[model samples]
Target chain A: MDIQFEPLQKRRLDQAKWAYTTRRINRDQNFQLLGGTLIPKAGDLVLARVDELGQHQRLELVTSRRASLYEEDEIVVVYGNRYAPDQFEGIVPDHLEPCRLVAAGGVAARLLNRHDRVKTATRITPLGLLADDKGYRINLSSARLPKAEQIDHKPLVLVVAGTSMNSGKTTACANLVKGFVRQGIKVAAAKFTGTGAGADYRALVDAGADPVFDFVDAGYVSTYRVHRDVLLDIVMTLGAEMSSNKPDVIVIEVADGLLQRETARLFAIPEFTDWIDGVVFAANDALGAQAGVSWLSARQLPVFAITGVLTASPLAQREAHDICGLPVYHTNALAQKSVSSYVYSCLKFRSQKQSISNPVREEVG
Target chain B: MTDTPQPGKIHCRTIEGMSQTNYFVYIPSETTDQRRIFYTVHGISRNAEEHIHGFIAQAERYGAIIVAPLFLKENFPHYQQLGSSATLERADMAFDHVLQDVHEWLKIPPSPMHMFGFSGGGQFLHRYAMFNPKRVARMVLAAPGWYTFPDPGQKYPYGIKSTLEWPNLKFSMEKFLQIPTLVLTGDEDDQRDKDLNKTRKIDCFQGLNRIERAERWTAAARALGRAYNIPTDFKMESIPNASHAYESYLAHPPFAQQIFDFLFEAQN
Candidate 1:
């Protein structure tokens, strides 16, 4: 059970601290040393060695100068997994043999698989050090990795947002959902951003959204700082959750303006575009309607309809149709059955496309 | 001395008057309440509740009592009849109803009032003021349709141009200036208000460099007052960042406060 430790490599170090200042390197599952403390204060080189014990690991460093004093919590090495130091040497699993190591600068280090032994090294760059700290010790096996399960027969729908906040987006979305429900379409709705009050979700529920969830339900008070990747992950996770309900349609509403940074980032991401099917632009007046259509069209997002508060006026409705050149419905008008029929025809076209592309598989054999 | 009635108390009374409109009486809070009585005309939307809310929010600090009558679309038929087109007829009916309700509530004669209009409401306020100038203490004409005095030998009723029909019966400044009026329009309002080049079209002697439609309307009112030998208390003010919807004016505290100061400070 002797655990083998590898010196940090330059490539691994560069990858470890991508866009971050500090990095952490751990030994034997426990004790950790920061690169900022162990490396040279100003361009000095350092060589660090890993020693294996029966059940613990240790690091011995040789530097051109005495190690610099560093405060705790300062990022030392960007990429190193933690391990228990008590059983350090013995814990290096028996799977990763012939490891090779690399490092960039003194910031990070890594170990890679060599022919028969672990080789460790480092490379320096302004971006930081790459570390192959964990040399290829044949101890860890991929056979223990978990497999991803296949999901069967899930329905998906896209939710579009307006370019401004409180532009009747949620109301239009709810009414559209209601229109679908009246024709026996079971629907689920979800909100993308963890911002603003839950007025839209409440309206959706009233409009017959069988299952509704907002970003708040996803355990976020706000998505202000949530990265695009994390946001897409949350959306996909919610989509998976909605799939369990077996909805005929899923309507998602984006909070905030479409040009908002978070929204732009989300829309720009390829995965998000793939998941989102149709786009709806909600606006307050004719000008906003026109602007929204132009902005979304530039981004190549599919716009299915334009709806909002201004729909209360016949002139605005007509102007919106003329300007945006899209099927337009006012919230009040959509409440009527004739308008609801038109909305259903649009949804039916979408539903037919979905059925054709992805025939709902009952189960994975 | 024992029989002298208190000025602020409103006495309840019923009447079998001949009128097709329902009027709500708003009694002033006190005898010292010199704030002008505000008569609000409902828009074609016919949401009296919303109009009342807007007026209350705008006029609360002024201690103004606002009387509004709800006239259904069916009763008014078109926007013109309910708005500025039939000025004298609508005014007579609206004022009579307001006066009767107020008299019943205050148990006194009809007092001088202020008039306010919103979209279509502005249309009614403009014509009502013309039909009965002596009744209005001050007026706020917001986003009204185009108006003009009748030409000689033209035989146009009330001196308005015959060919000038407002889109959706929403009038403009030419009509608003005949009386001392404050015009309020949003800064980012659509092309209609902006294209009028309101500053040059209306006489804005009092407001130089204030090139807003609302300011132009006020300037025209001021010029009309000066030319007609009426006291030149006319003023024009703009809601810095508003549009034709009047939302900005409603939201800005200083705008509301200034309006109160202009309307009531003159009265005291």
Candidate 2:
């Protein structure tokens, strides 16, 4: 039930607003990392009482505050669960008593599993729900997402997928964005799927992405476990957002390794490739790069280049170049202006050729 | 008249103690009357020459001598050994012996030196500062991958808790809190590549990514200082418009000025 509510603590008065201001967030309650029709659907906003403090040393109220400052009993409105590879125990089971701040980036969760590195997680106790101004429990599904317009043209979409978190996908995407921008092309970027955090989005902007967006902007705290269809909707919605900017090329980063449940399912779909013109696979080593490129090739996905953590070491780069069949772009070369130029031209030519042969004049001004 | 140096005057010498490492020393050519010595630590790339030279302009500006020693991988191996975290190698002993040599070579009688390290060097300096807080005037750590946090929850590379149980290598939380520390990171330096130390031991205490680890260490240090009722001279700074590159801050005028000012401005 949604109703007029009050915050017991001034610190949390701004926590919900922080999905905009802060890079990492830990909200009140009702956050889910999984992608399903679970608790707190889109548009369903509720009042959650902050119960306890656990693993999270810091908390974001409005402008990103600390959790250590909050008292025992305080009510704060927060978004759903956060699913991060580094520190997640499980998703929230019910609007229950011991809900965890699954992501320090600010998503709440039930928390099923976690790594040894995760000390005691920050736990928040949720009080009974309250009705909103309209008295209708805010459902995320009811949130208004812009419908994709039937467009005639498809922009050259370059998707950056990685073998796992910390595999250099963000940097690769940033490098590509910066490279393309220096080549006098309008570049835009969006992280299609990942836990909620502003790190990558900000990095992309610094790397010359004109306008950048992420799953959080698509109205989800994180896309870690969001259902397949909902995740797809988020992708299309993100495409619409980037397309609105009319970028010459759009680079999207798909979070996590290819073996990740969400990433694998997303990649398995044929429609997913329809949106992507080409893909760059980033891996931690040459072995993974070759395996990823070959895997994508077998699946009919276009992997034009291999890059990532391996590029930092010359030995790794040489090995990747030799084994991966596809062109291996080293870190320095990947960050140069020519790589983006080459990528842009290749994508442009492919799309133009597709439009010409298909008889359907797809969108591209 | 300022004690400015003639352009490109670096004195190279070998550490007889280690018998393998080469170091570069830059003293203001005009006068060797140095108020303090500022040592620059190199990262994993082992490019000590550039790292040592990066502080040249400021070294002259503040009349401080600069020393950058090269640690060959053949001797130091991975970050574990070079950063002085591993027990069997005792990088601490090497550094102690090496600093003695440096002081003997400089002929200034060993003095408290300002310690500056970038990337992997940051890892080494923090650990060095943790155990040898007495020898350092101020510790400037710029973007270390992992931190030996001031906590007993984890051991060594993860926290200051000693794993080797060396009798002399023990760290006092009180003494560590007193060491003035300045942590620098570009707001854009959020690189979490595989090269970043991600061992379970480190990942547990230091958080996942570099930014997380940096902020966490700062927060933890402040918190520890508060618990012990000690003063925490720790600050985590973020430079804008820069990523995870040495040149972004080391050579950039604005950042170099900020870093140099932190070390020299407060000097009497």
Candidate maximizing TM-score: 2
- Candidate 1 stretches with Cα past 4 Å from truth are A1-156, A194-196, A351-365, B1-268
Number of clashes in every candidate structure? 92, 47
In model 1, how large is the Cα lDDT of residue B108? Answer: 49
Isolated chain A TM-score, each model: 0.54, 0.80
RMSD for all candidates, in order, please.
22.8, 22.5
The TM-score between candidate 1 and the true structure equals: 0.34
Candidate 1 per-residue lDDT, tens place, B1-268, comes to 0122233332222233443555443444443243456666665566555555665544454556656766655445443333444442343564466576665654545656666666566656665665456666677655554333211111122222243442222222222334456766555543444323244333222122223334434443453332222354545455667655555556766755555555566665
What are the per-residue Cα lDDT tens digits for candidate 2 across B106-136?
6665658787888888888888777777778
The residue-level lDDT of candidate 2 at B196 comes to 82
Candidate 2 Cα deviation (angstroms), residue A344? 2.6
In order, the TM-score of chain B in each prediction is 0.64, 0.88
**Residue lDDT tens for model 2, A268-306:** 755567667778889899899878877887887867677
